[model samples]
Target: MEKERREKEEREEKERREKEGREKKKGERARRKRNREWRKRERKKGERERKIKEKKRERKKGERERERRKRERRERRKKGEREDREKEERREKGEREERERRERERERKEKERCDEGERERDRERRKRERKRGERKKAEREREESEIGEREREKGERERKIKERKKGERERERRERERRKKKEERREKGEREERERRQRGERENGREREKQ
Candidate 1:
């Protein structure tokens, strides 16, 4: 009986151990399935986070590109304004130089006209002086000619008066000589007549006494 009881006890023990081992294997399979499900969830969450980070980085890069384009446009506008201002200044300077040249030309022309007027006045004064000198010379020559003519007339009158006085003196001398000759001839003829009368009377007396 002891031996049979012992064999029975051993079979029961073996059965119990076999049942415990099966239960333990079933729990281990349940634990391994839970772990696989949790790992799958974690992997899906990591993929979602990486996609969000990549989208944020792309948006930041686009903003940087827009800022760079804006700066370039501003610089180009400033350069264009500077070029326009320089062109305007050059145009103003050229106009100022042209005005100065025109003013100088006008002044030169005015000076030339004034000099010509002075020369013309000098020529007129000289011509007037020559005419005055010629008139004075003509007057002096006429006066000299008149004086010479008067002197010739006075000389002719004196010569005529001297010739008339000489003729009157010769006629008076001839009249005195003729009167003396007539008086002498009358006295001689009267003396001769008286002598003839005396001789005739003496002859008559002598004849009477004789008778």
Candidate 2:
């Protein structure tokens, strides 16, 4: 009996020891799994931080480029303004010179006009003098024509005096003939008067018949 009890006790002790060993191995495995998971999480956090830093660097570079571009644009605008001002100044100067030239041309034209007017006045005076001289010559010619007409009248009177006797005989014959013509013209006039009186009497008879 005592030997059986000792063997059994020994067997129980061995089983207890084996169970403890199995539990220690399970705890160690769980600890190693937790450590691996923690390391993975730390690696992920480091990657996120690196990405954020890179993004910030890119944004800073973009901002600096934008500033540089803006500065260059401003400088170009100022330069363009300066060029425009210079062009305007040059245009104004050219305009002033043109005005001066125009003034000089106008003055010269005015002087030429005055000189031409004086010359025209002299020419008009010369024309007027020539017209006066021509008029005087025409009057003298008309007076000479009048004097010749009077001399012709005197010659005609002297010719008449030389032919007075013969003219008297011809005059007697012409007077006899003129008296016969006058008697015939008087008879014709009396016949015309009688015809007019007959026409008036016929017109009155017609008027009486109508009435």
The per-prediction tally of clashing pairs is 0, 0
List where candidate 1 sits over 4 angstroms from the true fold: 1-12, 87-211
**Which residue pairs collide in model 1, if any?**
none
Estimated TM-score for each candidate: 0.39, 0.41
| lDDT of each residue in 1-211, candidate 2, tens digit only | 9999999999999888867766775677578558757876896698689769967986897688669757875786577567757865786597568757866775676666768777677568657865885687578657855875676577557655755755587568868976996798689769966986786588557656744
lDDT of 1 by residue, 81-144 (tens): 4654665467447655764675577556556776776657745754675567457646654564
Each prediction's whole-model lDDT (CA): 0.59, 0.71
**Residue 37 local lDDT, model 2:** 72
Which candidate gets the maximum TM-score versus the true structure? 2
